[model samples]
Target: MQRQTTIKKDVSYRGIGLHSGREVSMRLLPAPADTGIVFVRTDAGGRQIHARAANVTSTLRATTVEENGVKVFTIEHLMSALHAHRIDNVCVELNAEEPPVADGSSLAYFDLIESAGIEELRSERHEIVIDRVCRIDDEATGRFVMALPYDGFRVSFISLNPHKLIGTQYEDFHIDAQTYRREIAPARTIAYEKEIDQLREMGLGLGGSLENVIVYNDEGWINPLHFADELVRHKILDVIGDLRLAGIIRGHVIAAASGHALNTALAKQIAASLG
Candidate 1:
């Protein structure tokens, strides 16, 4: 049986929130077995929000979880790192509403967790294994996500954009610690140049920069890409993190042009189907 795991020591970081544009400090602390991942709002009245789909309050541009009037924002990257490391229990303490952007990828979080090391618990890890095909589709938006029974976690993703700079792209990979760190963790979040002003006007992407995000224009990528299909790879990375909201899932996930909304929706469906 797979053992539940948590970090051996505390790991901390400081950075700016992608949308909030506020400086924040966060620390990941090891927790007891079966604790799962929980976010502690240190700035609030110590509100605790379990990192699960049931607590998710918003998926607009980023994932946010709220409990008792306290909300945590843009947590997908950190969540993805914990999931990749197979960390079943952790308490993420933060002094702000969001975690640091940290190059807009999970790479920094992965490194921090690796440095802290993983400790196995006496309890065995449990996962919600998909027994049948489950799907979530947005016909109007042309977005789709589905899960199928599989022995281990895997993700296949496709990104389709009208912009020539970010045309159709596809990638598939099995979810393992090494593979995730090398391939998916470093894939930075992506956005369109044309949408920058719109996003800022909507009070989002204020902390975004070329250093942390892959900006694409009608011409091409504003910043260098780590992989040719890094955009699609990042999409898969987000899916991996979002699905963790359902706890560990032993299944294969396939997504097309899906973002946080659809990703979390699929997670809710899988969680509800669990028996």
Candidate 2:
């Protein structure tokens, strides 16, 4: 049977939070069996928030978690990395409002987990294997996520960016620790000049630079992809992170024209139903 796992030792890192633009320090500490993944804001007197879809208060541009007016933003990338590494229970301690952006992908997250190592727990894992078809949609953008019954989890993604370099990138992958780390973890987030300008107007993406996220103009693929299929692989990486809001998922997910908003919406719907 698939068992729960946790970091064998504590791992730490420091970087700028994608949205907050403030330097933050975070540590991933091993937790007892069945503890589940929990985020504690040490900067706020140790406020603990369970990593579950129900706690997601906002999906505006990025996933945001809230409890009693306390908020954490830009969490999907880190959470996705943890999940991809097959970590089941962890104590994520942060000294700021958000986790570090770290190259805008899960690559660094993967590296940290590799350094810390993984240990199995006594308890068996609970996976949300879909027995019914479910879907969520954004009418204006025609973006949606659909889940179906399957033996193992998988994701198919299609991204549409107006930038000529990133107009339409498609990727499909069966979700697994090996495949995720090898294929998806290196896909950096892509952005357009127009959107960056808009984010600047709203005082967001203040820490974003071409170094962390791939900035594209009308030209195609400005950033060099570590993998030949980095664009689509990143989509799979994103799907993994977004699904974690459900706490854990065990079935296949197929999506098209989906982004953080739609992905989290589907996860919340699934998380609610499973309860």
Candidate 3:
């Protein structure tokens, strides 16, 4: 049987928050078996918020979790890294309201977790395996996500934009630790040139730069593309992270034109169905 896992030692990362534009430091510490992933707001009297769909308060541009009026924002990337590494229990301590948006991808977080090392626990791991198909759709946005029975975890994603730079794209992957680290973790988040102004006006993406996020112009990417289908691959990364809110999911997920809102909605439904 597979066993639960946590970091071997404490690891830390420092960077700027994507939306807040404030420098923040976060530390990941090992936790006991069955602890799950818990975020502790050190600046807020050590408030503990479990990384679960029920605690999610916002999914506007990024995922945010709240407990007792205390909030933590932009956590999907880090959470995705933990999930990719098969870390079942971890204590994430943050002094600010959000973790740094390092490189705008899970790659940095993955490196930090790797440096800290992973230790398997004595307890066996458990996952919420979908026995039947579960699906969510947003008619207005033409977004949809579905979970189907599978022997293991996998994700299939499709992205479409009216912009010529990023037209229709599709990707599918059977997610495993090695595949996640190599293919999914390095795919950076993307934003369009036209939307940059509006995002800045809304006080979001303040720390975003061409170095971190893939900027697509009318012609093509401002930076060299990591993969031919990097946009869809990044969508898969976000889906992996969002699904972590329901704990480790063992199934195949298919998504079309889905974003944070649809991801969290489907996560809530999946979590509820398991209960």
Top-scoring candidate (lDDT): 1
Clashing pairs in 3: none
Mark the regions of model 1 whose C-alpha exceeds 4 Å error after superposition. Answer: none
The residue-level lDDT of candidate 2 at 49 comes to 83
Sum up the clashes in candidate 2.
Answer: 1
Lowest summed lDDT window (length 10), candidate 1: 158-167
Model 2 residue 142 CA deviation (Å) reads 2.4
On the 0 to 100 scale, the lDDT of residue 128 in model 1 is 81
- By TM-score, who's the top model here? 1
Candidate 2 lDDT tens digits, 1-275: 88888999999999998877899999999999878888899999999888887788877778888886577888888888887777889999999989999998888998998899999988998767788987998888788888988887778888776555556878777878888887888888766766887897887898898778876666555677676556666767777887887866767788887877788888888888873
- Give the higher-TM-score candidate: 1 or 2: 1
Q: Work out the TM-score per prediction.
A: 0.98, 0.94, 0.97
Ranking the candidates on TM-score from highest down gives: 1, 3, 2
Candidate 3, residues 21-51, lDDT tens digits: the string is 8889899999999999999989999999999
Model 3, stretches more than 4 Å misplaced?
none
Instruction: Indicate the worst ten consecutive residues by lDDT in candidate 2.
Output: 158-167
lDDT of 1 by residue, 89-163 (tens): 999999999999989999999999999999999999887889899999999987899999988988999999777
